[model samples]
Target: MFDCIDWVNLPTFFSMLVARSTIAPVLAAATETEPEAESSVVLAGVLLSLVAIYFASKIGGEICARINLPPVLGDLVGGVVVGISALNLLVFPDSGALGSDSLIMSILQSTSSLTPEALQVTFEAQSEVISVLSELGVVILLFEIGLESELSELIKYGPQAAIVAVVGVVLPFTLGTMGLIAFFGVATIPAIFAGAALTATSIGITAKVLAEIGRLSSKEGQIIIGAAVLDDVLGIIILAVVASLVKTGEIEVMNIIYLTISAGAFLVGTIVLGRLLGPYFVALVKELKTRGPLLISALIFAFLLSYVAAAIQLEAILGAFAAGLVLGETEIQEELEKQVIPISDMLVPIFFVVVGARTDLAVLDPTVPSNRAGLAIAAFLIVVAIVGKVVTGFTVFGQPDIKRLGIGVGMIPRGEVGLVFAGVGAASGVLSDSLQAAVIVMVILTTFIAPPWLRIVFNDSDRLETVQEE
Candidate 1:
């Protein structure tokens, strides 16, 4: 065998073995690095998404500010422009958009070695991250609103606010439900679901506008804010009941009672307990000598309460609001408010923009044969949506000087809350395509119109007040 082997080939054979050994480790290291590379791609996608969000927010807000409209509206418009409805830049999987549909995903694919399967996974993860950020943005917004609010004034107007909230729910639910049933010939369940959609009042949007106009501390503003809080509670209960009905074809009475009681108990308990512990909270913050002790401690308190709220089937924003109300009574309240502003400036716009982004304006196209019926139903819902909440202003008694119209107009935009209802109905398969489209149309118009309309009403009211004073 030794004689058969060529002496000249020995060195080459030995080199081939060495090359195989070296290549194995290289391949193994690359296989190990694959997951890490995927992670990098995911992070890159998120960074790009944030970039798009910030750009849209600033551009839209600036344009709106220049036009004498609410900058929040501009943020929303910016979101719409970049969203699936227009640019397909910031689409989400919840909207039935594929990874391949996003321009951002395409860029990632071209510049990197992301496979189709991995791209889908990354798209979902990235969307989820952005969505959570959006949710946090709103929670922070509501917390800021609570900080700016007067607890005593809110309590003073509590009864009136309760009445407003109740009337807002009952009137819209009754009229919207009955109108769909009688006028649109929609079935009972679907009509009820659609009616439920009409009852939502976007506190975040209304609060932002009011705060912008320096009306956040006004008597009317207090009433609107108070009512909006109660309305949110009621909306939760109603949504649960309706969703239950959709799934099981029957209402869960016991579940409804539990939700109502729990909601009431949680709100009252948080306020009472937080007030009692307010001084201690201040003292604790004073003891801490850290970079952001005050802000960090406050956010921790807010997040704890928020977690509790979510655990109990209530909205996390409610807990955050309660936490703000509690902390607002502390000595550090003013300083804390100052610290929170910058954070709010960074985060709050994300909420408004994401809301606008999620809204599919395509539903409003009457040129589509299928959308014709929806347009008609949408018209009816819009009329009810406006009138139902507008009349609630008149329901306020004992405050004759309060801006009743402003209060009503403040509640007009259904915003993200209305979209929740439409989404649930669509998911349940209870809503017809036309009916779902109709609900979406109503949401879009009400959301787009309310900010500007509220500004005009309040500005006019202010002018009238000046004239009367003169």
Candidate 2:
């Protein structure tokens, strides 16, 4: 009978009659009853994963040094072993495509589920945040690379550097691209992906080798590093064009022509314009009275280049790399480096760990359905990747140079670039999931294995060159 009381007067009646509001206490009590441990547990796990990745990279990098591998290679493999696919993927199963009890698949699934769908969505959202963090990590990485570049040495060995870089990038790109067509019968999109992967020369390993032998400042060392930078710029542009074409399914003759002409032309234009404009821009910074302008200018140019590259259907990394080159040629280069280095030191390792965390360590078992194709492709691509670069080393325009070959071998590993391709290809659907796995494996192998192989090749070639001179 009391339920018939009028509700319409509740607001006015409460205001008139009540000395204090009851709503606040009721809301606080409800919140207090909710389980806060769930949120804490998830955050704690993410933090621990990040910490594990950090030490793994550092320890793995040291191991690489002892074994004569490029730390980049180690970082790449290390990341694959513990990445999103390996660690985080265990919690996810391609939307329940795999059985729950699969031994390898249960690693990430052990966390107690409060609710199935809610938990899955949370995991996916976490992955997305980590991916975004990786992007920021990349920016810091470039800053570090920019800092490592010694302009004085680059200028001294400029021609040799350009020559080596040119042959090194072009040959592997062509060979790898063609291999997709020849051996795999893969279409243009896939071929382009294979080619783009080859365009990168993992400098982390090369830089380490140079540092060890006291040649990091020598004629050979300077040229190799400089060219690797150029190769990165060009590779990124190619990646953009290829990705665009793949997405559009329109590989017209004009598209090919456009990609070819614009690639070199853009590089040339960027260099000429950047050099001519850099000094003036630095003067602007000087006039502005802001000591941080160099950093600002570098960042602006990097973004502008990224914008321009995307507008032309190229990747932003290409623009970032080009910006680094432009900055390398300026007096503010040193200043920019000083400003950016510490930031890189702190942030770049995070990017590397994030990268490691994203790598899906799950190999395509032959027993698994549709995995044989993936494994076969992975193996084929690995050989094509290695042989392609090694052969490119032998393509010198001058004398029979084993030293050049060794340098080319040293430049073979793909590192982040390959991952970018596999990721983009998979996301774009040009690469099937299995195909993506294959590509990732191929990328990991090339990145992890090439450094020590190159070291051996470099040593052998050094002896051969010495004998030839005698």
Candidate 3:
């Protein structure tokens, strides 16, 4: 039945109809029409991009789930399929104008030349909307994670967690910096930037994997979670230091110290202070007659913390996480989770898909000399990143019966944090395109490998008994 339809001619038929019916009338009426027409075009583009993202992510995720793989992996692949690199079916337009003669406008009149800035304005507007939604999605995700966590767990495992985090950061940073320097002959600053990108474990990916495998409450989960949080704090400080180095060409010890203090204070102070003030805020909100007041108030708190974190030169997600820590201790913890999960389910996919879309797989092709270099560096970094993180699991020696391999594997995924680091470096010109691509490859490989390894390590009853007996 589908073969009866002429797919190739369908687009031409629609184009002719649109040109004859819509574009012709719009152009003819332009002299009498208000400015709203142009705004509508931009709104249409933004809406279209969002619709594409949703369907692409949904289909991709479903496919991956059917294969017993992480759906997030599929979401990334889906974005790549429609992104500028491949199908180019989706348009995240550049900062150029949409002239009447442009591709979009030309659909109606192939030769008609209209206003110069029309398409550019619309594209910019669409881009801004997508950007805001992406940020909000990640912010909410961190906040939700914080809600599920207890501060006491972090406190109890503080020593081992610190060792895990410190070793995790140090080894990867060293290997990444040295490996890139040796392999690519890159400058110290660029090498450092690459190393910094490798240091942070993406707590989000690790936690999700643990949750999926039903080990989120296990002892290894506690250690891995605690270390990942600390690693995030360290990552923030490292990012600031790298940014400063790129801008000033000199590393400022005082600035690094200040950033460290600020990030530490935000985490410690927010949790402690939020815990103290949480009940009163909850009590005040309990008086509201509105539906889902607890959730609304909780989100407001999260957004506030996220804002503060951004203002203080930290990632908004950190503030969001802090908000979760505070809110998790409140009387309404379970209610908050109930409200937030559905929202997270919708938004988190957006963040992951956008991240995937940003990745251009073409850059990893070894046929191109620069890209070949990047691929080589990426290969080196992947090995270093895995081994460096795996070693941290041994740092858990003090804790008996803990699955060291599981903890190590749990800390392996670099995920979003690594991307954030590479993005910053790339934006600053410290990381050349190839180096940035390499970092991305490292991030992708680490993220892809860690989860399955974790599942295997966790499910090995024989290994578990051997370790327990030993």
Question: When superposed on Cα atoms, how far off is each prediction in RMSD?
Answer: 6.6, 7.7, 13.0
For candidate 2, the TM-score is 0.68
lDDT (Cα, 0-100) at 359 in candidate 2: 57
Maximum-TM-score candidate: 1
Candidate 1 backbone collisions, by pair: none
Q: Which stretches of candidate 3 lie above 4 Å from their native place?
A: 1-38, 89-116, 461-470
lDDT tens per residue, model 2, 42-80: 564455555655666787777877876666555655665
Model 2 deviation from native, Cα RMSD in Å:
7.7
Comparison by TM-score, 1 against 3, better one: 1
List the global CA lDDT of all models: 0.92, 0.63, 0.79
Tens-place lDDT per residue, model 1, 414-461, is 999998999899888999999999999999999999999999999999
Predictions ranked by lDDT, top down? Answer: 1, 3, 2
lDDT of 2 at 13: 75
Q: Give the CA lDDT, 0 to 100, for residue 440 in model 1.
A: 94
Rank candidates, TM-score, best first. Answer: 1, 3, 2
Instruction: Give per-residue lDDT, candidate 2, residue 258.
Output: 78
